[model samples]
Structures are given as C-alpha cells and as structure tokens.
Target chain A: MENIALLMHGFAIAFSLENMAAAIFGAVAGLIIGAMPGLGGITGVSLLLPLTFGMNPTTAIIALAGLYYSTMYGGAFSAILLNIPGDSPAIVTSLDGYKLTQKGLPGKALNASTVSSFIGGTIGIIILTISGPLLAEAGLAFGAPELALLVLFALTSIGWLLGDDIPAGLLATAIGLMFATIGVDPALGQTRFSFGQINLLSGVSFIPLVVGFFGFSQVIDMIISGEDGAVATKVRIRDCVPTGKEIKMMLPVSIREGIIGTFVGVMPGAGATTSAFLSYIIEKRINKHRDEIGTGSMIGVAAPESSNNAAAAGAFAPLLTLGIPGGATTAVLLGGLMMWGLQPGPLLFTEQPDFVWSLIASMYIGNVICLILAFICIPILVRAISVSKKVLVPIIIAVCVIASYANSNAMFDVVLMLICGILGYLMKLADVPTTPMLLTFVLAPMLEQYVRQSFDMTRGNPSIFFRGGICWFFIVLILLVSFSPLIKNFYLKMKDKKAN
Target chain B: MGYVLPGLSVLMGLYWAVKAFGYRLWVLNGPGGGLFPLIAGILAIIFGVVMIMRRYRTKKKSDFSVKSIFPVVSVIGIIIASYIIGLIPSLGVFIIAWMVFYEKEPWLKSTAVGIGTALVFYLVFDLWLAVPLPMGLFELI
Candidate 1:
C-alpha cells in the first residue's frame, strides 16, 4: 500500500512539464534512431547523453530511459519494412517481419510488433514496480564481501556468456579491468598508471570511451560496408490496423513472453537479445500456429518483439536495486547514473524515492508515448530507414567528435575517442565481443571498492570472502558459470561416445 | 588481425604486470594498489596465451586488408585539420568532401547539408550548451 502511494507520487513527478517534454522528445528521437540500421540503444543513448548535461538528474534519466525502451518499438520499423534489423534484438523480428512484407502484409507485421512491444513493455514495468523495491530491500542485507562476490559473479557471467570464444571474452574483461586501474587507486589514493600525463590523472573519461566504442566504430563500419539505400515501401496508417482475432492471438503470446523476458532481463549477462531469441524459440515449439511462424505469421512478429521490450524493462530491476547493469545498454545507463552523481544501489530507493519512483513511473508513460508515436509516424519512419548511409556516416562522425569533446571540452578526449574507436573496430574484426569490456569497465571500479572494503574489514583474511551465505551463493554461481563450457564439452563427448 | 590482437594482448599484459609491480602489491596484509592490476595482467596473459595457442592450432588464413584502415586515416586527417582550422569548420568540410567526392552528390545539396549540420552543431554546443569547442586558428585571429 505504501509502495502504491509512492508510485502515485512518482506519477506526479513524471507528469511535470519538463519531464513530460523530455519523454516526448526521447520517444521521437529514439524512434528515428532505432529505425536506422546499425544504430542500437547503446549508440543512441551515448549520442544523446551529452545533451542532458545541464538538466536535472531525474529529467535526464527520464529522457534516456524513454529513449532506451522506445528503441524496441522503433527497431521493428526497419525489420518489417526493409529486411534489415534496426538493432540486435530485432534480428529475430526480421525473419518473419520481412517475410510478411514480401506477402504484402507489412502493415500487419508492423501493427503486431507495435502492440506486442506495448504489452510486453507494460507487463515488464509492472513487474519492475513490484520487484525493484523488494530487490533493493533484500540487497540491504549484503556486506562488502557479498557485494564483491556478487560483482564478480556478474563479471564472470558476462565474460562467459557474451561471445563464442571464452578466451577472447576473458581478454576483454581483463582489458576493461586494467583500464579501470589507470587513475588514482580507489583504496590507497595512489596513482597507478598515469604515465605522467595530466589527463591520465583522472583516468579515461567514460563518455569519450563509450562514444568511441559504440559511435565512432559504427561510423568506421558504415564507411567500410559501403552505402545501400533502403527501398521505401508505402504503408498507409489505415493499413496498419489489426483484426480483433489477430490481437487475441498476439495477446497471450505477448503476456507469456513478457513475463519470461522480465525474469531473463533480471538475470546477469542475459539481455534483450537473449530474451527475444528464447521467446521466439519457445513460441516455435508451443504456438498453435507453429508451422506458420516463419511464414509471415503475426505470432512470429509478436513473440520476439514483446519479449525484447519486456527484457528492456526487466533490465532496470537489477540496475536500480543493486547498482548492477544487466546488459550493455544498462551498463551505459549505469555509467550515466554515476555521471549524474546519483549512486544506484539499495540506498537509492530510500535516499531518492522521487528519482527511483519517477523513473519507474515514466516507463509506463514512455511505453504509451512510444506506441502512439510509432503508429502515427510509421510513414515518416519508413522513409527514415531509407536515408542514405553516405549522409549518415559523416553526420555520425561529426557527432562522435563533438560528443567526445563536449565531455570535458578537451581535444585529448577526442583523440582518446578515436583510439578507442579504432580499437573497437579491431576487436570486432577479431570477432571479440566488446559488450563484456564495456560491462566490466563500468563494474570493475565498484568491485575494487567492495573488495578493498572487505579486505580492510577482515585484515586481509581470504576467508572473509567465504563467510556469509550470500557470498557463498555468488561464489557457487561464479564457479558454475566459469566452468560450464568445460562441463558442456565433457557431456557432449560422453553422448557421442555412447552413440558410437 | 587474429594473430595481431592476441599478440597485442600478450604484450599489453606484460607491460601492465611490470608497471603494476612498481606499486606495492600489499600493505600490512590488505591489498595495495598493485594487486588488482596484477591479477588483471596475469589473466590477460593467460587468456592471450590460450587465444594464441588456439589460433596456432587452427592456422586459419587471415582476411585482413589495408583497405579497412582508410576510415582511420580519414578521421586522423579530420583531427589534424581540426587543429589547423576549427572543429566545426573541419567537420563541415569533411561532410562536404565526403558527400561531394565520395557519394558524388550535387555540390548544392552537399554544401547545404554540410553548412546546415555545422550551423546546428554550433548553435547547440556553443550557444546553448556553452561547451567552448576548440576555435583553433579562429582563436588566434
């Protein structure tokens, strides 16, 4: 009941004029950015983050959060119309979405995707509203050791799950950790790796690093991939309306996937992409019209679309409650929270109820706003998908330079951004996933602080890390995640031997 | 690219480990500044070694070409030009050049986009955000 009262208060905050405008602007911008190929939530947020430098923290977060989930709605635009996924999560959507386009039912696919995104996003927000505070309350019991173990669990899981090559992922994780150690040491206040440069004193800036990694590397990719303009397909708004039976068929699937996606989002390392893939696989197995899944079925469009949006919402649970980012986009948002000087953790709920609750409350509004904007702007958005990559490539490069410079008004940061961008491109060329690196970069400093605190508490007793149930629980999970690859290989070999 | 990346990782691990040792690894039983970096360095070395070994066993042919470095070179040119002219002007020139020369767009349209984008950026970053973007030779003038 008290939580409900707080939620009402949150609604009041979200209803404020500034916040309302932020949400609307974010929705429009997110839709356009999401509809563009090769740009995802991470790049979109990184580009827009600098614009919010002077805004109130709550308003800034509200705007970014609005942008984050609306991308899920917008991503379906390109996938349904042009056969190119606007984002990674929407790759599954394109399988049936483009097939539907081929069958002259692009309108139906778009409508199904939009409706399912809304349903899944709404359900996810409800779960977050219920679970966020509960999770925060539970987190209050954790000590330094448990916190350290939990961070380690998150890092190891990300390293294990992000790429096909485990060694490559581990290398990325190590590199991120090493990067975090560049500035003054968190514990002893001793500078570790400054190499005498003054800019190195404060460490590498997050904005420049992120802009370089996600934005600038993308520019490089666009330039290299060569330009191909999407052929515009006309779909009138009237053509976008779905039948009652179609809505009914999508509703149950959306609800089920939404529920599942929320839980998946709450888990460390598993993100919207995973959630969407899992939902589609499950839908393939169980749907009444299973055979029609890849044959332009509405259920195919709904299943992944709904789950990805739900997972986007679900990702916030861990981020708000435990200060742990569930995925790469949330990791970037976590960095934003820190940049805003708002510490995200259990205390965030008690310390800043207005901030936490308002952000949560805004999600519901953002979902509705996204849905309406998606429907009304379909014609324009389809055109946006056709915008020339030649034009986009140069504009993104300029934005990257400006964003990196705007961070601290230093040209050095711009140079750093370029370096990181090149590095990011090289990493991609080597098939090394950069997501774990970004996640680790954000979490490594926090892990250092917790580990040091634990060591200080126990006078460097290694046993301190194994003291409590929470610590042990995290330890067990970390070990299991770390060795699961080996276990799987062994099991596969045994099965093959048996078959022989 | 495959061999280069793992080899770079190995070298970086070596450098990091040596630099980390300069800081005390421990202070009175508690971890000092060097401990975490040392751990990271060691992990990097282990992972890099494994990656290199796997690459060696596979002996996969590298598909890398010098062509991919063109974007990097172009951006570096822009950075150098930014120092000579200004960030806004250099970016405007980059847009015009890329569109006109690379995309083969009409001069009128490319110029309009170039100047228009630069103008918007100036208004936002300078007038609104007050970011004090680099003026370069403009500052000297």
Candidate 2:
C-alpha cells in the first residue's frame, strides 16, 4: 500500500515538465552514445556529469540512470548493421545480430533487441525499488573488517572469474589501483606522489580517462581501419518488426535472464558486462533452437541486450542504498553526488525519498523514451556514423582532450588522459580485462581507507582482520576464491596424468 | 603474450614490494596507511610473475595478425597530433580533412562536410554551451 502511494508520489514528481524533458534528452543522448563503438554507458554518463551541476540530485540521477539503460537499445544498431559492437555488453549481440544482417534479417533482429531491452530493464528497476532498502539494512551492520573483506571478495571474483587469465586480470586490477593512488593521499592531509605538481590534489578526472579509453580509442580505430568498420554495407532495414513466433520465443528467455541479471546486479560488484556475457552463455545452453545461436539467432541479440540493460538498472540499488557504487560509472555518479554535498546511504531513502522514488519513476519513463527513440531515430544516429572517421577521430580526440582539461581546468589531466588512453589500448592488446581495472579504480581508495581505519580501531593488531565470525567468513571467502586458480590447475594436471 | 609475462614479472619486481621500507620509514608514527595497497601490490606482482613464467610460456599464439598494424599506428599518430595542434577548431578541421582525404572521401564533398561540421560545432559548443572556442586565424570577424 505504501509502495503504491510512494510510487504515485514519484510519478507526480517525475511527470513534471522539467524532469520529463531531462529524461527525454537523456534517452536520446544515451542512445547515440550507446551506438558509438568504444563509448559505453560509463563514458556517456561521465560526460553528462558536469551538465547536472545545477540540477537537483533527484533529477540529475534520474536523467543519468535513464541513459545507462537506453544504451542497451542503442548498442545493437551498429552491431547489426556494421558488425561493430557499441558496448562490451553487446558483444554477444554482435554474434547473431551481424549474422542476421548478412541474412537480410537486420530489422527483425533490431526489434527483438530493443523491445526485450525495455522488458528486461523494467524488471530490473522494479527489483531495485523493492529490495534496495533491505540490502542497505543488511549492510549497515557490517563493520570495517566486513567491508574490507567485501571489497576484496569483489576484486577476486571480478578478476579471477575470467577463468583462464586470472593472474593477468589481477595484475591489471593492481595497475588500476596504482593509478587510483597517483594523486594526493585522501587521508592524512598530505601528498605522496604529487611530484611537486599543483594539480595533483584532486587526482585524475573520470570523464577524460573514460572518454579517452573508450571514446577516443574507438575513434582512433575507425580512422586506422580506413572505413572498413561496421556500417560498411548499404543495408536498407526492412519492416523492423519481429514476427509473433519470434516474440513468443523471446518472452520467456528475456524474463529469465532479466530476473537472473537483476539479482546479480543488486550485489555490490556484479554488473551489466558480466551479466550480459553470462546471460548470453546461459541463453545459448538453454535455447530450444540452439543451432542458430551464433548464426542469425534472434534470441542471441535479444537475450544479452535485454539482460545487459536490466543489469544497468539493477546496479543502482547499491549506489542508492549502501553508498557503494557497483560499477565505474556509478562511482563517477557517486563522486558527482558527493561534490554536490549529498552523501549516499540509507538516509538518502528516508530524508530524500523523492530522490529515491522519483528516480525510480524516471527509469520507467526513460525505458519508454528509449523504446520510442530507438524505434524512430536510428536513421538519424546512422547519419552521425555516416559522417566518416577521417574528420571524426581527430575531432573526438580534440574534444576529449579539451573535456579532460575542463574537468577542473588542469593541464595535468590532459596528460593523464593520453597516458591512460595508451595504457587502455595496451591493456586491450594484452587481453587484460578492463572490468577489473575499472572496478579496482573505483574501490581501491575506499578499500584502503577501510583497512587503515579498521587497523586504527584495533590499534595495529594483524589478527583484527578476523575479529567477528561474520568478518572471518568474509575473509575466508575472499582468500579461497583468490587461490582457486591453483586448485583448478592442479585438478587439470591430475586429470591429464590419469588420461595418460 | 611475450609482453604479458615480462610486464607482470617486472611490475612484481619493481613497483610495490620495494616500497615497503619507504612507506614505513616515511610515516613511522602515523597509521599503517600503506599496508593494504602494499599487500595487494605484492600479491598482484607475485601472481603475475608466476603466471608469466608458468602459464604464459606454455601458451601458443594462433590468433596473431599484424597485417593492418601500420595504418592503425598512423591513425593513433593523427589523434596525438590533433591534441598537439591545440584541439577545438583546428583539431576539428584536421580530423575532417584527414577523414575526407586519407579515408578517401572526394575533395568537394569533404570540403562541404568539413565546413558544415565546423559550423555545427561552432553553434553547439560556442553559441549554445557557452564554451569559448579558439578563433585563431579566423578571429577576424
């Protein structure tokens, strides 16, 4: 009953002319950014962070979160038409989506992708509304040791979960942590590695780093490849409609993936990219018509696109409730919110119910806007892609450098951006999962603070790491997962010997 | 793949494990602020070294393709030059020219497209967003 009243109140606030316009604008912008390869949800949201400077936190968060899900719809366009996945989460989509294009089913594949994204995204938003408060309460009782352990668990899971390249992933994560500490020390009121530079106080700006890594790097790709990139064909999309058979086939799978993805996304560290990859794998295993999965399978495009966007919505639960950002872009949002003097936590739910509730309402509104925009404005976005890369790459790089410099008007940021861009490209070449790097960058400072604070509380006792039984459990969980690679390797060796 | 193992081992040997003393010496009386990052850093390095020496050495390279690397390098250079040439209008002009010519769009169409995009940028960032654009040689109204 209260949920309904609160929801109605949220609708009242969300439906206001100003907020609605912002949501609409955000949807359109997000759609475009999502379609551009290398520019993911994180980069798109980070660019809009500054634009939210003057708005209310509720409205700002609503607009930004709206963009996050809108991308799932937008990412498929290029993947289908050009065979270039716009977002990493859409990589699964490219398999069957591009194949569909080759087989002259591009329009049908696009419709399945977008409509399923809307369905999945809506499910994620509702789960966040119902369960976020409870999760926040559960986290409130966890102390510093538990928090530290949780962050450690997150690092281990995200990195080692890649299965074969666990060590390289962890190393990339460590490098990201190193980058996180490059500026002034957050505590102790002193600078460590500033190297006597003035602009190192506030550390690196998020926008420039993301823009360079994802946005500029991709623009560079377009130019280097000499226009052989996606959208190379003169594909005239047919009736962008899924047949009833297609719709019937997708409804159950999308729902299952949506539920599973939202559940994972609400957890502190799991997010859209992981969810999309995992869901696509699961979809392939369970698909009734499995043979078509990687070759013009409509389910392939629908499954991941739906779940990935749903995961985007589910990620906000942690950000809103426990003051913990589940992913990179949410961390950027957290930083922006703090800069505006709004501390994220349980109090955000109670004192700023409108910020919580209206933001939820806006997700519902945003999903609809995304559906409409994707259905109507794809041809418009295609025009942007048609403009060619010779001019586009340099213009984007120039804009990215300027954007970095303008974050705080620091020249140092521009330099950091170029270096990070190179580093990002190198990481890509080395197959070091950028997810670990991104996750570590967001959580390292907080993890550091939690450890230091816990040690201080216990007055330098190393054994304090396992103070309570709950803390002990968390510590063991992290340790076990971190060392699982060794166990796996040993098992494989034994199996080889037995076979011989 | 060769770079992977070396990178990991080098990071392990050079960056964090050696910093223990400097960190302890620098802030003897303060909190053990460097402990977690130090430990994480060391663990990361050790794991990396282990992986490179053992796992990396055993792996084979079947997916290697270097046919199109030079063009990629050139494009990256063009991007860096975009920044070195002062961003905004000049870089925009350069990007447009490169795309049209190097990417092989016709000269007349490229010129029109370049001028159109330049005008759009002028309107969007300068007029609308209120960001100041570098006028440079075009400063004379």
Candidate 3:
C-alpha cells in the first residue's frame, strides 16, 4: 500500500509538464546521438550532463533516465542498418542484425529488434522498481565498514571486468585512486597533493574530468585515427511492423533474454555488452535452432537486442541503491547526480524519496516513449547516422571547450580538462582500461572516508572491518572477484595441457 | 613512448610518496590524512614500475607516429587561440582552420560553419543558459 502511494506520488511528479517535456526531448536527442558510431550512452550522457546543472535533481534525472535507456535502444539501429555497431553492446546485434538486413528482411529485423528492446526494457524497469527499493532498504542497515568494503569490491570487479590488459587496468585504477587523494582531506582537513594551488584545493572537478575522459579523448581519437563515414540503409514505414507469427516466435526468447539481462546488469562491472553476449551464447546452447544464430536468424536478433536493453536498466540497480555504478554509463550518471548535490544510495531514498521515485516513474514513461519514438523517428534517425566526421569533429571540440569552461566558469578548468583528455588518449594508446580509472576516481574518496571512520571507531583495530557478517561477506566476495581471472586462466591452461 | 609516461609517473609517485610521509600517517587513535595518500602514492609507484618492466619484457613497439601529433597540435592550437582572442572568436578561427586545412573543405563552407557555430554558441551559452564564457576582446564590445 505504501509502495503504491509512493509510486502514484512519483507519477504525479514525473507527469508534470516540464518533466514530461524534458523526458521526450532527452529520448529523441539520445536516440539521434546514440545512432552515431563512436558516440553511445556514455558520451551522450556526458555531453548532455552540463545542461542538467540548473534543473532540480528530479527533473535532471528524469531526462537523463530517458537518455540512458533510449541510447541503448538507438544503438541497434546502426548495427542493423550498417555493419558497424554503434557501441560495444551493439556488436552482437550487428552479427545477426546486419545479416538479416543483407538478406532483404531489413524491416522484419528492425521490427523484431524494436519490439524486443521494449519488452526487455519494460521487464528490467519493473524489476528495478521492486528490487531497487528493497536493495536500498537492506542497505540502510550497513555502516561505514560495509560501505567501504562494498566500494573495494566494486573497484576490484571493475579492474577485473573492464580490463583486457589486467596490469594496465590495475595501474590506471591505482593512478585514479591517487588522483582522488589530492586537495584537502575531507576527514582531517590537511592537504595532501594540492601544491598550494587554489584551484587544486577543491580537488579535481568531476565535470571537467568526465568531459576530458569521454568527450575530449574521443575528439582526439577521431582526429588521430580518421574513421570512415557512416553508410545508412533505407527503410520503409510499411515494413517496420513485424508479422503476428514473427512476434509470437520472438516473444518467449525475448522474455528469457530480458530476465538474463536484468540479472547480469545488477552485477557491478557487468554491462549491456556482457549481458547481450551471454544471452546470445546461452540461447545458442538451449534452442534447437542453435546453428541459425549468426546466419540472419530472427531469434538471434531478438536475443541480444532484448538482453542489452534489459542490462541497461539492470545497470541502474546498484547505482541507485548502493551508490556504486555498474558500468561506464552509470558511472557518468552517478557523477551527474553528485554534481547536483544529490548523493545516490540508501540515504537518498529516505531523504529524497520524491526525487528517487519520480526518476523511477520517468523510466517507465521513458521506455514507452522510446518504443514509440524509436519507431516513428526511424527515417530521421537513419539520416542522423551519416553526419561526416569533418563537421562533427570540429564541432565536438568547440562544445567540449565551451562545456568545460561553463562547468566552473574558470579557464583553469578548461586547461585541466584538456590535460586530462591528453592523458586519457595516452592511456588508451597503452591499452589501459579507462572505466576502472573513472570509477575508482569517483569511489576513492568515499572509500577513504569509510576506512578512516571504521578505524577511528575501532581505535586502529583493522579487524573491526570483519566483525560484521556483511563486511566479511564483502571481503570474501572481493577475494573471489580479484582472483577469479587468474583461476580461470589457470584452469584453461590445465585443460589445454591435458588435451595436449 | 610506452615507457616514457610510466617512467615519469614512477618518479612523480616516489616524490609524492616521500612528501606525504612527512605528515602524520597515523594519529594514535586512527589512520591520519596522509596515511591513505602515502599508501596510494606508493602503490602508484609500484604500478608504474610494473608497467615499465612489462613494457621492457614485451619489447613492445613504442614508435611515435606522426599521425598522433595532428590531434594534439589541433587541441593546442584551440587552447592558444582561445587564450589570446577570447573563446568565441578563437572557436570561430579554430573551426575555420580545422575545416579548411585539415578536412579540405571549401573556404566558403568552412566560413559558414565557423560563423554559424559561433552564433549558436553565443545564443546558447550567453542567451539561453547564461554561462559567462570567456569573451576576450569581445568583452570590451
């Protein structure tokens, strides 16, 4: 009964004229941006984050929520029409999505993809609505030690999952954590690495860093490694609707993948790409038409499309409940919320119940908006994909420069953003994962505060971290997550040796 | 190129680690401000050293491609331009230069894009969002 009342109140807030307008605008803009290759949810969200500065946190988040889900939906358009995937999550979608397009069922493939994306997104949001509050409620029981351990677990998981090169990932994470330690210590008021610079005293600004990391770095990439222009396929509105038999065939598999996607999304560091690929593999194993997965199979198109969208929603679970971002996109969202002076996690639920619930309500509305807009806007969306790099690149640079300065009204931050952008480009060159670094930068201060608090309470006894069963559980969880890659590698090596 | 950045990072990390050690690491009751930083600096140094060692062992090619310099130069150009003439004019100038020289667009089109972009930025930042962007000489106007 309480849940229903809160939900209704949330609907009242989300359905406001301004909030509704923001949601629609965000969905359309996100769809347009996400269809462009090399710019997906993270870039779209990061680029648009500055616009949210003047708005209320609820209104800000509702728009961002729309952008977040619709970006995932929009990513499929390019993957199906062009052989190119818009983002990592769309890579699997392209395998069969493009194949189907090649086979002259472009309309059939697109319709199935759109319907499945909506189904998956709807399931994920429903689960998030119910599960998010429960998770946050459970988290209200945690103390500093548990929170600190949770951050540690998240960091390690990010280092493991986000890294293709483990050592470099670990190095990037270490560097990021060190960067977070600069400026005055929140607990002790003693400056560590500010070097007496006034600007450095406030610590690194989040927006500048994010803009440098995602926005500036991408511009650098586009310049250095020139990319081919986008090639778009034409689609007719008449062919956009799937047949009844096709819908029936796709429904069960889409639901299964949606469930799989939600579960994968709820895990820290597990993202849409992982969920989509895992569901694709699982579908091939369980379904009798396994051989047809990559060969223009409708089942193949439905499976990954559904999973990726669901995973995008699932990725929100940890972000809202525990203040831990599950992937890069959510990490950007967490930063945006923080910029608005709104902290995510359990306290946010109690303190800003309206903000939290309204954002959730907006997600439900945003999904429907995405379903409708994604279909209605296909012709326009396809045209958006073919924007040339020459025009876009210089424009991006100008925007980055403007946005960085606007964030703090300081030229020093513009310089700082540029420096970080250069470093980000270097890190990419070295094959170091940027996600670990980004997340660690966000989490390090919180982790430090918790560690210090726990130690103070226990009078320097480290064992206080383990006194609680939850903290111990996190400790074990971190251990498993950190070493699992090594264990897997060893197991694989042994199997290879046995076969030899 | 691969080892250059990591080597520099190692030196910086060690310098900070020593500097951080001068502060109170553990204040009798609990860990102090310098404690986490000192640990972090030391870890950074270790990671840097590991990165350097791995680079040496792998014998990875660290050739500096001329292609990479184009973007860096472009970024530096924008920064210098923005600093000298103010942000809006500098943006207009930079876009024109980028489109004409690098992208090989026609002068007319580049000028149009440059002017249009500047106008849009003016309306959006100054008019709509009210962001006080650096106007340089334009501020006098």
Candidate 4:
C-alpha cells in the first residue's frame, strides 16, 4: 500500500512536461540507434550522456533509462528484416526472424517480436517494482566487508563469464583496477600513479573513457568493416497485425520467458544476451512446436525477443538497489549516476525517494512509449535503418569527439579519448572482451573503498571478511565462479576419457 | 595481434608494480594508496602471462590490416588540427574529408553534411550546454 502511494507520487513527477519530453526523445533515439547494425544501448547512452549534463538528474536519468531498454526493441528490426542482428542480444532473434522473412512472413516475425518484447518488458518492470526496494532494504544491512565481497563477486563473475578467454577477461579486470588507482586513493587521500600530469590527478574521466571505448572504437570498426548500405526489405503497417491464434501462441511463451529472464537479469554479470540464449534453449526443449523453432516458428521469434527485453528491465534492479551494475550497459548508467553527483545504492532509495521512484515510474511510461512508437513508426524506422553508413560513420565520430570534449572541456581528455579508442579497437581485434574492463573500471574504486574500510575496522585482520553469512555466501560464489572454467575443462577431459 | 595486448599488459603490470612500491603499501593497520595497485599489478602480470601462453598454444591468425589504422590516424590529425583551427571546425573538416576522400561521396553532399553537423554541435555544446570548447588560434586572433 505504501509502495502504491510512492508509485503514484512517482507518476506525478514523471508526468511533468520536461520528463515526458526526455522519455519520448530517448525512446525515438534508442530505436534508431538500436536499429543501426553497429550501435547498441551502451553506445547510444554514452553518446547522449553529455547532452544530458545540463538537465536535472531525475530528467537525465529518465532519458538514459528510456534509451537503454528501447534499444532492446529496436535491435529486432534489423534482425528480422536484414538477417543481421543490430546487437549481440538480437543474434538469436535473427535465427528464426530471418527464416520467417525468407518465408515471406517478415511482418509476422516482426509483430511477434514486438508484442513479446512489450509483454516481457512489462513483466520485468513489475518484478523490478516489487523487488527493488526489498533488495535495497536488504542492502542496508551490508557492512564494508559484505559490500567488498559482493563487489569482488560481481567483478569475478563478469571476468569469468563474459568471453571465451578467462585469462583475457581477468587481465581486463586487472587493467581496470590499475587504471582506477591512478587518481587520488580513497584510503589515505594520497594520489598514486598520476605520472605528474595534472589531468591524471582526478583519475581517468569516465565520460571520455566510455565514449572512446564504446563510441569512437565503434567508428573505427565501421570504417574497417565497410558499410553495406541500407537493408532492402519493406513492411506495410497493415501487414504487421497478428491474428488471434498467433497472439495466443505468443502470449504464454512470452509470459514464461518474461519471468525467467527477469531472474537471469537480476544475477550479476548475466545480462540480456544470456537471458535470450537461456530462454531460447528452454523454448527449443519444451515447446510443442520445438522442431519448428529454428525453422521460422512464431514461438521462436517470441521467446528470445521477449526475454532479452525483460532482461534489460531486470538489469536495473541491482543497479538501483545496490549501486552494482548488472551488465556493461548498466555499468555505463552507473557511471552516469555518479557523474550527476548522485550516489546509487540503498541510501538512494531512502534519501532520494523522488529520484528512485520517479526513475522507476518513467520505466513503465518508457515501455509503453517504445511499444507505441515501434508499432506506428515501423515504416519510418525501416527508412532510417537504410541510411547509408557512409553518412553515419563521420557523424558518429564527430559526436564522439564533441561528447568527450564536453565532459570536462579539456583538450587533454580529447587526446585521451583518441588513445583509448585505438587501444579499444586493438583489444577488439585480439578478441579480448572490453565489457569486463569497463565494468571493473566503474566498480574498482568502490571495491577499494569497501576493502580499505573493512581493514580499518578490523585493524588489518582479514577475518572480518568471513564473519557473516552474507560474506560467506559471496565468498563461496566468487570462488566457484572463478574456478568454473577449470571445472568445465576437467569435466570435458573426463567425458572424453570415458568415451575412449 | 593476439600477443600484443597481453604483452603490453605484462609491461604495464611490471611498471605499475614497481611504481606502487614507492608509495607506502600499508598505513598503520589498514592499506594505503599502493596496496590495491600492487595487488592489481601482480594479478595483471599473472593473467597476462597465462593469456600469452594460451594464445601461443592456439596460434590464431591475425585479421589486422593497415585499413584499421586509417581511422586512428585520421582522429590524430583532427586533434592536431583542433589545436590549430579549433575543435568544431576541425571536426567539420574531418567529416568533409572523410566523406570526400575516403567514402567518395559528392563534394556538395560532403560539404553540406560537414557544415551542418558543425553548426548543430556548436548550437548544442557551445550555445546551450556552454562547454568552453577550445578556440585555439582563433581565440588568440
């Protein structure tokens, strides 16, 4: 009942003209960005973040959050029409979505994806609304030790699960940690590793690094890959309407996956891509039309699309509750929170109910807005997707440069952005995942502060970290995640030996 | 391509570890500025070495080409040009140059895009946001 009152208050705030405008703009931009083959939520948010600097924190966050989830909807456009996924999470959608297009049912595939995405997103938001404050309430009990261990678990899980190479991912995490140490140290206020440069004293700025890694590097990638001009498929709005039986088939699958994807998104490091893959696998195993899954069934289109959108919504719960990022995109959002001088976590809910609830309220609006815009603007969106990469590449580069410079108005940061962009591109070529690095860079200082505080409380006794159930739980999870690769390797070897 | 990043990581880890020792590792009972970096450095070195070894074992072929260097070099040129002309104009020139020379779009279209984008950025960043974008030699004049 109290929650209902708070939500109503939140709705009052979100209903403001400025906040509504922000949400609408974010939704439109997110859809266009998501439909672009190379851009995703992270790039969209990073590029637009600098523009929000002058706005109030509540409005700024609403806009960014709107963009974040709507990208999940927009990502399906290219996947269904062009047989090319707009982002990683949409890769599974392309499997059946493209098949449907080949069968001249592109409109059906798109409708299934859109409806499921709406259902899944709504379900995920409902779960978040119920669970977010509870998680924050639970977080209030966490002391320095528990917080430190929890951060360590988040970092380790991301490093372990992100890519094929565990060592590479761990190396990225270590590099992020090393970078975090460059500015003033949290423990003693002593600056280390600044290399005597004035700009280094404040540490590497988050905006420039993020823009470079996600934005500028993408520019380089586009140039290298060379643009394949606009997608050729066209869809009329009337053809997009689904039949009653088709809706019936999609509704149950979407509801089930929506629940499952929310849980997956709540877990640290398991993001929309994981949720999409997991839901698709389950759909393949259990659905009556399982054999038609990869062969262009509506259930196939519905399953992953709904789950990924749900997962995108689910990611916000931890971010809002604990200040820990749920994935790479949320990590960028976390940095945005800090940039606005707003510290996230339990205190945010208690101290800034307007900000928390308003942001939450805006998600419901954003979800509906995304569905309406997606349905009404399918023709315009297809035209936008066909915009030549020749035009997009240079424009994106310009945006990246200006955004980086706008953060601190320092030419030095621009130079830093260029350097990071090159390094990020090189890292990509080496097949080293950059997401772990970005996540760690955002979280490392928090981890360091927590660890230092714990040590201070215990007078250097490390046993303080193992004192509570929460600490032990995180410790066990961290250890298991860290050794998971080795366990998998051993199991594979044993299976091979047994077969022989 | 594969070895380069891990190899750089090894060097960076060594440098960080060595520099970290100069800062006090411990301050009274708790850690000081250097402790976290020292640990991170050591872990980086260990992981970097393992990455190198794994790469060696797999021996993946490199997909890198000189074409990848074009964007990096072009951006460097833009930065240098920003100091001479100004950031907005340099970016304008970058767009025109990129579209004309590289993408081979029509001169009129490239110029229009270049000028139009620069005008929008100036309005948004300078006029609205009020970021003190560098004027470079233009400021002196």
Which numbered prediction scores highest in DockQ against the true structure? 4
TM-score against truth, every candidate: 0.69, 0.68, 0.68, 0.68
For model 4, report the TM-score of its A chain.
Answer: 0.61
| Candidate 4 interface RMSD after superposing interface residues | 2.3
Judged by DockQ cut-offs, is candidate 2 incorrect, acceptable, medium or high? acceptable
Task: Give the alpha carbon lDDT tens digit for every residue of A176-279 in model 1.
Answer: 88788889886778887887878878887776776676667755665665534223344455766888999999999999999988876776556787678667
lDDT of 1 by residue, B20-108 (tens): 88887887667788888898889888988888888789886555556567667767877889888988998999989988987799999
Q: Looking at candidate 4, what is the lDDT of residue A413?
A: 81
- Number of the top lDDT candidate: 4
Q: lDDT (0-100) at residue A240 of candidate 3?
A: 54
The lDDT values for all models are: 0.80, 0.67, 0.76, 0.80
Report the number of the highest-TM-score candidate.
1
The reply for model 3, stretches above 4 Å from the true place, is A1-136, A162-164, A229-363, A370-382, A428-431, A485-500, B57-59, B83-85
In CAPRI terms, where does candidate 1 land? medium
Model 3 lDDT tens row, A1-500: 66667878999999999999989988987887666544578867887799899998888899988998898888887667654455667766776886786565666777788889999998988888777756434434566787778667756656433425667867777778777888887557877787777888878876567667665776676566565332223455566577788788889999999988887677665578767776776676577777787678888889988999998888777798789887788999999989999888778778988998898889889999998987776655444434567776787677677767776688877788888787777776666656566667776886778888888888889998888788889899889877877898999999999999
lDDT of 4 at B131: 71
Write model 2 residue lDDT over A1-500, tens digit each, in one string: 68668877999999999899889988987887776544567777887889898988777887887777787788777666555556656656776786775565666777888888988898888877777777545434566676677666655666433436766777767666765665555345455445577776655555556545554444444544455444333445454567788899999888988887776566555567657766766676567876677668888888888888788887787788778887777888788779778888878878788877898899999999998888886545444444444545544555555555544544566676666665665555556555466556756766766666676676666577777887888778777766766888999999999999
Provide per-model DockQ scores: 0.51, 0.29, 0.43, 0.55
The segments of candidate 1 whose C-alpha lies over 4 angstroms from its true place after superposition are A1-135, A159-164, A221-363, A374-382, A428-431, A493-500, B49-61
In model 1 chain A, the worst 10-residue window by lDDT is: A226-235
